[model samples]
Target: MSYKRVIRFIVFIALCVQAKQMVAQNANTRPNIIYIMSDDHAYQAISAYGYGLNHTPNIDKLAEQGVLFNRAFVTNSICGPSRAVMLTGKHSHVNGFKDNHSTFDGSQQTVAKLLHNNGYTTAVIGKWHLISDPQGFDYWNVVPGQGEYYNPDFIENGVKKRVPGYITNITTDFAINWLDSRDKSKPFFLMYQQKAPHRNWMPEEKYYHLFDSTQFPVPANYFDDYQTRTKAAHEQAMEVARDMHDAYDLKLAFDLPKDQQKGLAGNWQGIYNRLTPEEKKKWEAAYGPSIEAFKKANLSGKELAIWKYQRYMRDYLRCVQSVDDNVGRLMEYLKANGLDKNTIIIYTSDQGFYLGEHGWFDKRFMYEESFRTPLIVKWPGVTNKKIASNSMVQNLDFAETILDMAGLPIPADMQGKSFVPVLKGKKKGDVHEALYYHFYENQEHKVAKHIGVRTDRYKLIYFYENNEWEMYDLKKDKSEMKNVYNDPSYSKVKSMMQKKLMELKKQYNDPVPVVTPQI
Candidate 1:
């Protein structure tokens, strides 16, 4: 009980405090990052968003633990371009990958390259549709293009090899495998992406009957005649009733007589053609009854439209269910390995999709369903817990935010402003007053090239190819049923929006290209 004994106890306590401080410092200095993206995953379908079409428990868990942005949008609402925007932190025009037809320039600076140079190991798995070998990752294994649902071939490290399994589950497996093998000493960034609920929605065999007993009500605007819309809407070919094929899309005409198949048999045979005999047997066993019933029903007109919508919803939601299941798998892996504590996890989509809205099933428009995407961010120690932010953010902001979170310098050339402050519930004001969008793909869906601006209460779009303008008061017309560009009551608002749209284009350096309408 002397001075030496007391000094010894004090020294032990100080050593313990020093070790605790060093642990906190390491956790803050180099936190790992995991960004999970789903193709054509709409905000409306997630149960957390309250649209009530289907449940996504894993995605909802991400929202429950972190910040969910209610107004997250995309710069361009297409597959390849949306990813390009996120990688480059610039609009599609600035990145030079404006549409699916174009190849991304690999030599350009990407966020991955930046992170890789700044002391972070980077990997991108699944659904890399950029049409170029991934340039800036320590490792990459991606699907070719709009990858198949069953037994898909993956381009792993530039070698094409067929992987045997459902696409979503296989993707998750590879992502976790990479995580297991990564260098533990260095922080890592992984883009675990998925291809599901995309066109010709194909669910895994296990979820074949998941939504069979559930009846989904048709969207009120599902029968929209495109009365108030412009030529862009009426001339498009994405109608669920007309464009969704029985053979390929709905998987119904496989049993019908080839002569009675309405000539769609040739176009859609590939989806079924890819399945092995055993896989095909399982798939048919699950869907055969519905196909037989549909053939016997003799549906036509509104009855046929409703029937097609329900089939579309069932298959789409089933695919989503598989995605949700895989998400849970990844979450469990992270938790089990003790990586959940210091890793910043993000869940989003390349862009939103139309779930039978406006009689359409594809995404290219500037409408709310396609333009607005789901964004959930979970930063273990930084983000506000279980909060939803109304601040308008975009896919463009993702790269800058990642760099910011990693304690790295955001390159000045990257155009996207980091919304990390918004995620932390700080600096709410000064978020952009309007978000700009531009879509350039014309030959695919017949939707004309367009540019527009969206604010909280209103949206203004210009169909440049058609030389038409459409405006909507979003507060009143969330469905975008009525375009009020020419309405006298909205003239003042239209003028202001028009000016703002042009200003945004200038601000983003997206000049409208001169069009010549192929002779």
Candidate 2:
């Protein structure tokens, strides 16, 4: 060959070899991310969080191999808004999904879309309450609305279909199936969410007998008189005694007349309608006797309230039991396939729930029970094993952290700071001086519209509709039973917190405003 031709050929071969090596290096460095989330999962329920309500061996295993964020929280402590904040790395107002009533604008930029655009494969499987078609995912199979615990319907790549079997197990099955079938050439991001342990808690047939023998003690404030608080405390309809339904929540007295079926029964009926004859047989075998015996008890007053608490705890824990079991199955799959070493696994919830705390069962208030959610992360090589961090991270920071872990540049428009450094134990102190929260949905649940800020020691809330303010010294009043906003000793503390709350509101570009009108 001529000298000139030989020189050109050599250069081309060198370029080809360099490109191949770069691709291999990228594949080796980029970790696969699997984010597992559940709806209304209270941090207190997790044994790892030390609340001691239930044992979640599989989730606890993640904490053993990684660090747990003890002070994790949500920007907006509700379902859709929380998820929206996580996706966009911004607060609800900025993301345009302010509450459950707001719809997510899919055309906007999201972490998933950003990752996909930057050469990663993305998928979201399980509960999606945003009420819009997923835009960024390469694959999506989500349960419609608040999905049924049994035989739920899922929208797979826009095709609606009901899959038989328990929803949690079924969702996990789809997740593992995706992992097995994904294009291994590129790193994958799978949002493996679950619809379990939400409202109308229904345990899998196998888990129906799980928590039956356990007698849960009622919370200390289960009979909270709302004496120290304002109208908001007394007005909410989420109290376990007043809100939990007969046929729906407790799965009792289904044989009673339709008129006698206290509260809403639609959720229960939906679960029942989906069960096959064989599944029904197994379910009845487990719960039938309990239902009959409860009717015979004719319990009342304090006895009835305590019974309801025990029943709620048992059912909630049973659902959690199934979740833990399915999580173990996912962990086993990852380990057996030798994919555990390079994967970053995360476990969190949409928001926290009330397990008879303050006699309440739902979330939305700025109380600690609904405000603080558990955040456990395990990144095989990156995370410090078994270490726990007290840094105040939020659902707002989740997107930025995921992007940073994946070695992508966080968008400037995103309002949250990446907590990857905190995860690695390189940083100290709270992520921010304070975390800001705004709850817009009001009047329906009797929860007044409010905005608040929580610091490491104290919390200050402004109930604008009622023109009331509440301040608490968290160290002393962990239950938040006392509102020290007007206390003489805390007057200075309240002023400082109030200023900080407004500063945060301005920093986030959500200035003080009038409360949203009641729906």
Candidate 3:
């Protein structure tokens, strides 16, 4: 054997070993991430939560295959602020977006920026409602704000493309396309946001006629007079019929007088022009059959409101249908590309929405309907598919969980504790004995500023704006119909929870309960 040849062969083997090590190192470096956010979606609306009014087979399947957290909540009940919280892992105040009207300070450390710094490709598609344009994402395409359902304009990689398609389906398309074209060498993180069931409730053509005749059962508190609840049923502005007449003008007939229905000062097109030609045709088809069916059915005024409830529920669910269809497609795409095992797919909304639970249509109240979001995660590590954890989770935990699961560093500013332990079906962080909720209400509906804490058995809400309080024993009265705030028996419970709320405020740096309204 030649000594020179032996040395050359040994060197070649060493070089190969180094190259293989580098490849393995890269594989062990980071994981691909996808996070989807939907607007005005509720835990009740999803079949995964098991209320069972609508069919969300895909989202439900995600839960069946992965971990479904029963008690996920948003920091703020609104869109922009909630998103900011999710990104920064900080509260609305810390994130510099107290409300939807405020701007997002992206300079603060974020999950996207952290992932980007950690050498993962990141992208956000659909519904970037932040006052400033997005940052840290390698690629971004988002709707302007409360984006149009038809002929929506999207700011793509750079250029703007106005496409005539529903926002839900189109947003998923953008996300899936980005995933398909992402750098194969590096793992990626994608935020797929959707603009559906937000406002004016526009559904796709195929879904327009969905459940046109079926009667959706009336909510338990459907005819609630707002007797006990000052704000719960007092929102005359957001009601289906009243807003249709006054604020929204949905009640105005095509030939109605200009001043009354059209509004003499403002643009009338806003009321009539929201619908595209295709959408108009579908609207007629959808309402036409239902209205005629009503005439023959001969429902009186009270029965008529019941009919209206059914119609409204149907439209909202149909909009959800489009969202569900795309989720199915995205899941299918993962299988086709063999990205299923490597990918972590999640389905959730910006906040839990009200779906006629308490005769309510919008989300803002600290009630369970509006506060708790339905979260389903399908990660590759979990062995059990249909596992349900009663452990309480909140929106704050999201940013921490994502970073923690990725084996990345979470910033000091993040207020949320990581639920990665809960996801793996292990209790690492404290399994929430009581969760705090504070919604400083300032919006179209005008709910009041309130703070509350939810223990496993008791729920306490203190109305700071009005100095009133409400408490419920969730175990006894899950519907929260009977408020035991004034009951003499619960005084001790109320004080105990109030003390807990103060502790939470100190912990989270939330405002101390001031008697006088700061505003």
lDDT of 1 at 138: 93
- RMSD values for the candidates in order, in angstroms, are 6.0, 3.0, 4.2
TM-score of each: 0.92, 0.95, 0.89
What's the true lDDT of residue 71 in model 2?
A: 89
Which pairs of residues have clashing backbones in candidate 1?
Answer: none
Q: Rate the local accuracy (lDDT) of all candidates.
A: 0.88, 0.87, 0.75
Candidates 2 and 3, the one with greater lDDT: 2
Candidate 3 residues lying further than 4 Å off, grouped into runs, are 1-29, 230-236, 244-268, 271-279, 291-301, 428-430, 516-519
The true-structure Cα RMSD of candidate 2 reads 3.0
lDDT tens digits, residue span 74-174, model 3: 76788887888889887776677877778888777889998888778899999989967888999999988778777788988667778876788888888
Top candidate when judged by TM-score against the true structure: 2
> What is the alpha-carbon lDDT of model 2 when measured against the actual structure?
0.87
What's the CA error at residue 510 for candidate 1, in Å?
Answer: 1.4
Rank by TM-score (best first): 2, 1, 3
Off by over 4 Å in 2: 1-21, 255-263, 511-519
Poorest lDDT segment (10 consecutive residues) of candidate 1: 510-519
